[model samples]
Target: MTGAAQIAISGLDPRDRAAIEQLIQRHAWLIDHGKADRIGELFAEDAVLYGIGPDKIGRAAIAEWGRQRAALTERRSRHLQSNILIEPLSPETARGWVALTLYRHDGPGEGLAMPLLIAEYADHYRKAPDGAWLFAERRLSVLFGAA
Candidate 1:
């Protein structure tokens, strides 16, 4: 198995890992589909997101940012997440990284399309009282195609 997989196997519960993975996937889907108003549902009340313009603190601010982005009807985007690796910090907390590839364009299809950005998301998660995982913090690091 890969190093990250090995660490995940040793450090985190299988179910918790799966739940966190789903949380990550849901974030991508919501953003790609213009469901930004619900973006806060994936995060803790006081979550912080960095590396996307100014840092957004708290769920309200994050949701507002999402609303602003969703207002651009002409701009289209798809966020692909892969190479997810999750590690447990405590029963209630975990951390992980996801390889992010972003494809974006405006108006109709072009001759060819390419990813607009390639990056990794460093994520911290917290388990809620209801046993749901939520993003506590997420920081993006660009590997290429920064704009």
Candidate 2:
């Protein structure tokens, strides 16, 4: 198996791994569907997001950023995530990486398109008191295309 796949197979309980995966997927869905007002649900109260314009510290800041971006009605985006690998740090904490391929355009019509951003998210997750997994930190590293 590939290194990431192998590591994913071993660490974290199956249920926890699945939950984390859902959390990651939900983040992508929310962004793509313009559900910015719900963005706070995916993160810890004090989470930080780095390398997307400026660092957004705290859930409130992140939600505000999402709201502003969503207000731009002309822009459309699809965030595709893959190659997720989660490494357990403890029962309630873990770290992972997700490969992101973003296709975006403004004032859309069916036309030639290409990925606007190819990036990786280096993520840290924490399980909340209510037993939900949430992002504690998410750092984006762009490998190709626009930031």
Candidate 3:
């Protein structure tokens, strides 16, 4: 594991940090809005998603999985991510973690549950040739109140 000192020693430039933050924001928005196909753009071509089920590799496969997940009945959800920490491992590689809270309703008339599903997202990122920060891998770990 990377120590606190290591994280303190490593830093991402403002531009890199901003790009990554934007990438994360867009990811949540796209997923919440049932635009799962667009979520693929935020990932690397060979990205891996250690999602709710088995690990999904490659952007195409990930997108397909997201599409199927989005099709699983009409629902509404709002995702809020906070405490984002990005540690630069190299000029082109970094690791990030963020706390996530999901407010969800089962259907059009269903209301959100009292206790939210609080989770943390651990991400590996790589700078692409196009100067975009893409997720190399993402794993979501729920802290409490599973949905």
Candidate 4:
């Protein structure tokens, strides 16, 4: 196993770049705000989200997964993203892999169930005719974690 593997964000862009940036931002926004139901708005209805454990298919299942996860923990989490690499797979499609670091903060003395949960997201983007580049699929892989 590789020790300390990290995600890398690089390359060029101006307009297309913005699409990739928005993709990640939306991900952070939905997760951090505890609005897991809103994930359906970000992904295609038929899109799949992997690494969210079993029953991982379609937007509804993924949204349910997020809700279940949120119920299991009491700590408030903040998702820290870095080392993102977004590549234009095509005019209507793009791919990105980014690093995710989640901080679960409890009260002063509460021990964290997930002190550090680091994963990398494999994302596929599709451009809507209305001009929003939304996620087609998001496959998550755990890079480093305590559980």
Candidate 5:
């Protein structure tokens, strides 16, 4: 197990934990609501995302990627993150682990009942000069999903 995996939210100060938790929960809310333009605000200017799709670097690229994702109208999806563990490496840096579930809605008549993907994420974060925690790097590993 990595150092991040060894820490839990409960180990941190309540205020710090809450701040970190808000940063994470906001991601789900923003994506589900198609607020792509604002999504990039969650990450640092030079952040990187590595996952099943093409990796993205920098906030502009990440925001553009979100815009493209928002343009997908054929289906609606919901992303939920759970079991978030934040390990503060310093006052300005931290690592996190979270379990993610993605649910899909096929059409207007289709209920939002099917889970399309499940994954685990390991992430690094940094406190920006403005004093907000932002993702520096996010690495996602799928546990199960449709081909």
Candidate 6:
């Protein structure tokens, strides 16, 4: 973790667990629902977002890429993230890892649907000056996909 990140979550008592949980949940909803703008809001001005198919940089680019991805698939996909671990590396820095499964009906056959294994994500988060947990960097390795 970094100094800024540490300060952001420094006072996170037990009661703040729910808030953190919601933050994570909200992140999923934003992406799964194809709410690009909403998802972009989660990132800081200079935030970096990678993975989720292909490569993207900056919050604005991420939003456009997300929108395009949703459009190209021509099918709605639900992304599930589990077993997320958040570790504080410093007062204002932290890292998170999570397992994700992406499923949709855009297979060869109309009725065909399968899970895309994103495997795991190694994310570095930094607390922005405005006190928001934004992805400083997110590295994703795809385990399996139809690509």
15-67 per-residue lDDT for model 6 (tens digits): 33344445566777866675644666666666676666666678887777667
Tell me each candidate's TM-score.
0.88, 0.89, 0.87, 0.75, 0.85, 0.72
**Higher lDDT: candidate 3 or 4?**
3
Question: Mind giving the per-residue lDDT tens digits that candidate 2 earns over 45-73?
Answer: 99999999999999999999888887877
Candidate 3 segments whose C-alpha is farther than 4 A from its true place: 1-10, 113-115
Which predicted model would earn the best TM-score? 2
- Clashes, model 2: 0
Clashing pairs in 6: 1-89, 1-90, 1-93, 2-92, 2-93, 3-92, 4-92, 5-92, 6-91, 6-92
- lDDT by residue for model 5 (96-130), tens: 99999999786676674768889988999888898
**lDDT: which is higher, 3 or 5?**
3
Judge candidate 3 at residue 1 and give its lDDT. Answer: 42
Residue 115 error, candidate 2, Å: 0.6
Q: Ranking by lDDT, best first? A: 2, 1, 3, 5, 4, 6
- Per-residue lDDT for 52-81 in model 3, tens only? 587888999888887886885677788989
lDDT for model 2: 0.89
Candidate 6 regions exceeding 4 Å error are 1-21, 70-73, 107-110
Query: Distance from true position, residue 8, model 2, in Å?
Result: 9.9
Clashing pairs in 1: none
Between prediction 3 and prediction 6, the one with superior TM-score is 3
For TM-score, candidate 2 versus 4, the one ahead is: 2
lDDT of 1 by residue, 61-141 (tens): 998988888787777888989999888877888899999999888776552368999999999999999999999999999
Cα displacement (angstroms), candidate 5, residue 117, comes to 1.1
Worst 10 residues of 3 by lDDT: 1-10
lDDT, each prediction: 0.89, 0.89, 0.85, 0.72, 0.81, 0.66
* TM-score for predicted model 2 compared with the true structure: 0.89
